[model samples]
Target chain A: MTFQVILVLFALFAITRTSRQYRKRKVSLYWFLLWTGLWALVIGIALYPTTADAIARFVGVERGADLALYLAVVLLAYLVFRLFVRQEETERSITQVVRQIAVQHPSKPDETH
Target chain B: MKTIALIPAYNEESRIAASVRDARSFVDGVVVVDDCSVDRTGEVARAAGAIVLRHVINRGQGAALQTATEYALDALNADALVHFDADGQMVAREIPMMLEPILSGEADVVLGSRFLGRATNMPFTRRMANRLARLFTLAISGIALTDTHNGFRALSRKAARELTVTLDRMAHASQILDLVKVRRLRYVERPVTITYSEETLAKSPSSFRAFGIVKDILKDKFFTRI
Candidate 1:
């Protein structure tokens, strides 16, 4: 019972933070909705363990906790891949800008040389 | 033809001057892209009669070469461009040999081949690495050449203008070969001597870094679009 209460409280806190970010315009409406839905699902599973078990059985998973772990792992891996691609893109942009600056102001050799 | 030698240097203050001086003799002008070296690479190159272009931050050799290529084609209006290493390893005397194919309109690009000529003081490990890189290049780009990553190359203005180096580091060498094959640019290899010193060997990328290059190239081939 205490563990269930803790999970619910954590989910509520995350939902609150997500809503705050949405209000501050830091997150788009699409992201806000996705996060809110995710937290609500978490709250529902925490409040009703039977619902998770039912869904897990339907998905051919033995345990609800195991299903959650698998989902989390896949999502984290996808997010990491996205971050790596984004970092490469950012680095390419920086190189392009630096190249332009170097090209514009060339330092010619002195006349004496 | 109006030829310009493009040298991409990073903290090569001691060797940049000699390389620039030697390259200036063969080409009409020498343009050195200083890759934000903490040392006085730019000053030394400039004093050696090279047009110095300074990068605000250190990008990499590939990025520096791309910047120099743009400057050579656009600003200098060069008819041909020679890619020379800032390190004293490459013999600037061979610039003409590299440029012959390009000048005669026989090939769009000319690559230097140490295997065909001489690799003075080259270590056994370096030779093995070069062979492996050649095979890798063949597998990836479907182009077979004696040397895959020689820094000494000559490109016609059209070749230089068409080929773009997107990889910003050691991988750029492989990327250049890939572009040559993809763009269907006529390329030939010329015998050139590379005298490797302890300093040059020390500065070269480690064997482990080859894995990184492979990974970068694979990612570029499959994940990213040029």
Candidate 2:
């Protein structure tokens, strides 16, 4: 999983660099990065022998840590969906506001003759 | 006779030059509000003889028009205001026709209608969407308008000055209908042919987007209504 850790680091680096440009969709992207990092952390932790042994006994599964990771993924998916709805509403309101400005403002004089 | 034509554009550099050239021949003044377009929409329109207002960030069609109308009413001291689209859908000859009702004091506002009678070069899909919107507006406003979202509408300074339009997006058409119904403005629709170009056809909002516009009106009716 060394390759995966490097990939996560690269993603974090890129997101941090371009976060400001994410203005409108920043929150959604932030959540995505957070969830991804969480999964990576969980995976790296589960690879440990002591944690895997403890999880296997706790959940009555051959790999208890895997079950725990699966549950986390499901919960994260639900949370992301809720946040997506909120983002859609925000964008919709922005669209409505912009359209109003278009009709309300008149053009200025551009010619002399 | 002192009127200004308001044209709000975003990335319309290609078509606006021709549109502004057409508008200058008819109106006393032409103002093109560039709503933070990421192009030379301002420079081209200004060079085409239009007063250009640049928004620091992209607002929307309604917001840009709102900016232009306020300037037309306040700074320009216009006697009448024409809400013209930046797209080349309207003709300069129809400006006089739209002006007649307001100029003659027959109506406070005049709407130029393409569906009311014979029109030229109208695409089927765009026509369908407009007709659907017209029907919805008719039901909501209880006004039998054939062209609910006609971009060639004109209003006297008094009427235009009084409207407090707040919708900043495409929902401004519904906002107009609601205001007309609420304020009881002396509004009339006149037949005017609108020409549709390939660019305009491409810009038509998708059916999904149209549904979003309808939902926006409903949201306002529930959340922001009196």
- Residue A23, candidate 1: alpha-carbon lDDT: 98
User: Which structure among the candidates has the greatest DockQ?
Assistant: 1
Write model 1 residue lDDT over B114-203, tens digit each, in one string.
999977978888789888998999999999999988889999999998889999988999999988998999999999999988888889
* Stretches of model 2 off by over 4 angstroms after superposition: A1-113
**Tens-digit lDDT track of model 2 for A1-113:** 68646656765665555555455565667666765666555555535646755766787766755676677799889787667567656765675555455444534342434
State the TM-score, rounded to 2 decimals, of chain A in model 2. Answer: 0.43
> Predicted candidate 1: what Cα RMSD to the true structure?
1.4
User: For each candidate, what's the DockQ?
Assistant: 0.78, 0.14
What are the per-candidate TM-scores when only chain A is compared? 0.93, 0.43
Model 1, docking class: medium
- How close is chain B to the truth by TM-score, in each candidate? 0.98, 0.94
| True contacts reproduced, candidate 2 | 0.27
Find the candidate with the highest lDDT and give its number.
Answer: 1
State the local distance difference test value for candidate 2: 0.76
Model 2 residue B86 lDDT score: 80
